[model samples]
Target: MTIAPSRSPAPSGATWQRADWASSFRNVGTELADVAVTASRGTIPAELCGSLYRNGPGRLERGGQWVHHPFDGDGMITALRFEGGEARLSNRFVRTEGWQAEESAGRFVYRGVFGTQKPGGALANAFDLRLKNIANTHVVRLGDQLLALWEAAEPHALDPHSLETRGLSRLDGVLKPGEAFSAHPRFDPGHRGAPRMVTFGVKSGPRSTIRLMEFATADDPAAGVQAGQLLAERHDTMAGFAFLHDFAITPNWAVFLQNAMAFNPLPYVLGQKGAAQCLASKPGEIGRFFLVPRPGSAAAERHAKPLEVPAPEGFVFHHLNAFEDEATGELVLDSIFYADFPSIGPGDDFRSVDFEAIPEGQLKRCRIDLERAATDPAGAVSSDWLEQRCCEFATVHPARQGREARFAWMAVTEQERGNAPLQAIEKLDLSSGERRVWCAGARSFVSEPVMVPRAGTGSEAASGPEDDGWLLCVVWNGARCASDLVILNAHDLSEQAVLELPLAIPHGLHGSWVAA
Candidate 1:
């Protein structure tokens, strides 16, 4: 796609002044209410069907007070549904206790995990450990239910058709009240044709405890799932402190990159800081990997302990994909790795964060030699940095979720080396050493791109590569002070269409595309 330069005047900020990126932090209070999406560039592809559901912080302030961190903002869900040759867009906020109470009283009522403090000083916040589930991290559809997810707590169910909050979901009694469910659920297109959702929750301490689960969604006549039903469960105990946000899964294995870190709750107990602020990385230790077997796998029958592997001393927040090579007894895992946990002290302002000083995530390919796993799991782990271009929010063709594939796409920075806002979408050809970038330049920041398989049409239908699809994502256009849903050809990284919106959406983290 052709790169575009900024047309609007730059906005000012206190610290590093990147005008385009600075606008991504602005508030998007009004909902779209099912508005028709108009394309300004090219025609919408006929093969592209179904809605692109995305979630992130929308409202950043309560009354006149600003939130200390963008992650603390209220969850806003956006759906851009594509049909025949047109698009329909709608957005809504997931109503939660904190959102309702703060809106009703016209002020901040809850302390957020990141740094949004209460009205008074630390004195008023002291010893009050109550947490309000923000439900702002991700959105997914399984079985017959639509859910807005947050990593630390249960998901809030929403009406998929109307974007209305229904209530909290318990996975058909699989999860009890106050149970923790990971927001980052990995969809396993298993070999048996039984697609399952895999996720886990952690309780970190001296000896951390992990609860892993696999659940199947009930299929309805409409071809949509009704709700997720429990299929399997396992409890594991690991040594040392554990902080897990995401994991990767093959047909019979689930792998997690656990950062070596320590948690101190004293400052949080004294109301001086949020619980997240207390986490400190163990500088001298190597990062670890926890590999657990699937319920029906041979390892499970033996009641085997989780295979532990030591990795390069660093941190990993997200993984692109993974697959098992049963013939070779190797597991190929590709993920984004950082040198350390990127953080700031309680006194620092998140809005003025120095991007250059923070560690940028680079793609890394890790190979686990399962043959040597039992005797020396740590020594068996080997990794190599794929590319130096800073990137994150990586994805691949839906059908290639847990298999060896040619390409992986993700949001990348405009520059080649340093850390900056993600302003482009990169297509990394793993088989070949070629790369393609579709950049909107310094004026537009993007979200995670969701790939949809091209429907069978004419000649391309019978047997096209899995990577044959269109890439869809939302872009915050700083030039227009608005947002656009951009579409690109996955094969060539060419712009197909740009559906412009009247308002801007705060840059979001993750999203999914459901086939029609």
Candidate 2:
């Protein structure tokens, strides 16, 4: 397939300005109650009844001191409830232990993993290996409970309706104290029984170990905690430190990409830099792909070990989708790759970052002949670029996950090339390489788009057309210094409604949609 640049033009009079974009990073200190919001353009679909929950860094500064990186800020959640052709918005902080302590003392009391240090310099930070769980990556709902997730620590359970913190949860003893639970969880539309949620946890050291877990969805009320029933768990250990943030899955396999990077903890141990800053990418090294057979699968009984294939030379953070090609006997994986590790150096200002200096993420497709990989691992993998444009946070319909999906929607840069803020949402047809885009004007920025399929289209009974849905995203309107909830037709990138929000939300990481 030959992909081309989008021909759809930006909104009239749209122009990019750095100052306008930078205004979105300000700290928001107030928690908002349910505020009635109406669409300023177009009309809300009457059938659209669900809740949109988003998680991101909400506070960038404290006690006159600023966080070195936005990732270090405390977590804040924004919830939007759509019902009867109207919407209500609410925002609240996660209120983690660290956030509570900092609020009580009115200063920075703990060091952050990304580079926010304590007030007393190196003497106060040295030898302090304790990490503060900011709970600021993603928000997900499992059965009747909602969780605020931070990949480095246990998740903090929140009241689904009020957005109130209910303290940290161990998933009914599935996770031990301080165990890592990944923020990225893939929902598997059931093939045999009921739909399940698949997620993993990693422990990195001289040798890294990955623990894959599957839980029953809300369909099973008798499950643990009325939702997250642990179905199957498996572990695989690999050589070298694994800096894994996200992964992909299919019906029979759990896939992971071990990027070509090394971690040096000297700086972090000595209070000179954050733990994430210690990672350095190897220039000419190739990555390795680990395909672990899912527990209770026929492949697990046949092969006692995972199949390792040589991946292309790049760093991957998120995957669009993965599937097993039954006819070709191959496993295909689609992901976003960066040329190298993206980082902000110590003592540098993150707000004034130069987009050109860092590598832009591009979508790529990798096909691995599983039969060949079992015998000849080195020659089993081949890959090519799917979309060369700068993009991230791509999603397909939930029902199409771990299957052949033809359509995908993601946040992309407004320009045809080069790295910049994601100012638009693009719909791509994988087979035909056709592209459609809806730019939010140059002064606006977008978050990850969540595709909510129209009710009754795709479910356990049958998988419908991929694009029969709506794309819900939060847009930062720089012109008005506020945010807007924009809903667009998934099939064609056209605005359906734009509900003006009362407050501005910072650029977020990830979000989810829960149907009412």
lDDT of each: 0.81, 0.88
lDDT of 1 by residue, 172-248 (tens): 77777767788898887653356778888877789988899987754544654444877788988889888898998
Best candidate, TM-score: 2
The digit string of per-residue lDDT tens for model 2 on 1-516 reads: 222222234555566788878888889867888988999888999889999999999988889999989999899999999998999999999989999999998888988898889999988888899999999999999977799999998999999999999999999999999999999998988854678889999999989999999988766544433468888999999999998899988888889999988999999999888899889997789889999998888778877888889999889999999989999989999999998889999978988998989899999999999999988999999898888999999998888888888888889987778898898888888888888878887678889999999888857426566687789999988888889899998888678888889888988899999999
- Each candidate structure's TM-score, on Cα atoms with residue i matched to residue i, is 0.94, 0.96
Candidate that would win on lDDT = 2
Q: Return the TM-score for candidate 1, rounded to 2 decimals.
A: 0.94
